[model samples]
Target: MQLAANKGFATEKVLNLHEISHSLEFYANGRLVRNDDGRQRKFQGVSEVIEFVKRNGGERVLVVLPLDRVSEMNVDSIEPTFIADNGALALYAVRVR
Candidate 1:
């Protein structure tokens, strides 16, 4: 995320997911960005994020998830656009039409 921010992409939201719900926190300029709507928003998963990208007319999706969940998430089913390993974690940037 720091790298992305350094490259000029705003770190808009961070999601903390649980079994039943997720919390999203926004950040800007290295500080927390408050939400006029509300402090917390519904949590979204990788599949939901893919839908969002598709809905916004995006052709690709970048997903950062635990390495253990890679198979659970069916990441191998699709060819990844980019992948980076960071020990037990990984970053998956893939084209999703």
Candidate 2:
């Protein structure tokens, strides 16, 4: 969260989901990618990965579209196209097709 903020990628970050749960959004390369509420799901508490992905969900759509909506809680932007989703497969197929 600190790194993202320092980099200007993360506009604001919360230590806990109390306020964020009301509304969560993710961004990537200047686009709103993911939108979710981290409450009432396995992704409880505060996780920057969850926050980041939720922010970039759509851009990662090809590779991140199929995973459980809240699966992002388990990962961060550590790898390129890191979150594997059926959308990832579709991305390859689209290129080939």
**Each model's Cα RMSD:** 5.9, 13.0
Q: How does model 1 score by TM-score?
A: 0.47
Candidate 2: 10-residue stretch with minimal lDDT: 88-97
Prediction-by-prediction clash tally: 0, 10
lDDT of 2 by residue, 31-91 (tens): 2222466232222432433454466441221121222333433334333223222332111
Candidate 2 runs further than 4 Å off:
11-40, 43-97
lDDT of 1 at 96: 53
- Model 2, position 33, has a per-residue lDDT of 27
- Identify the leading candidate in terms of TM-score: 1
Give a tens-digit lDDT track for model 1, residues 1-97: 4544453433333322112112212222222222468543322455665555566566444445566656534654344532454565554554454
Model 2 global lDDT (CA atoms, 0 to 1)? 0.28
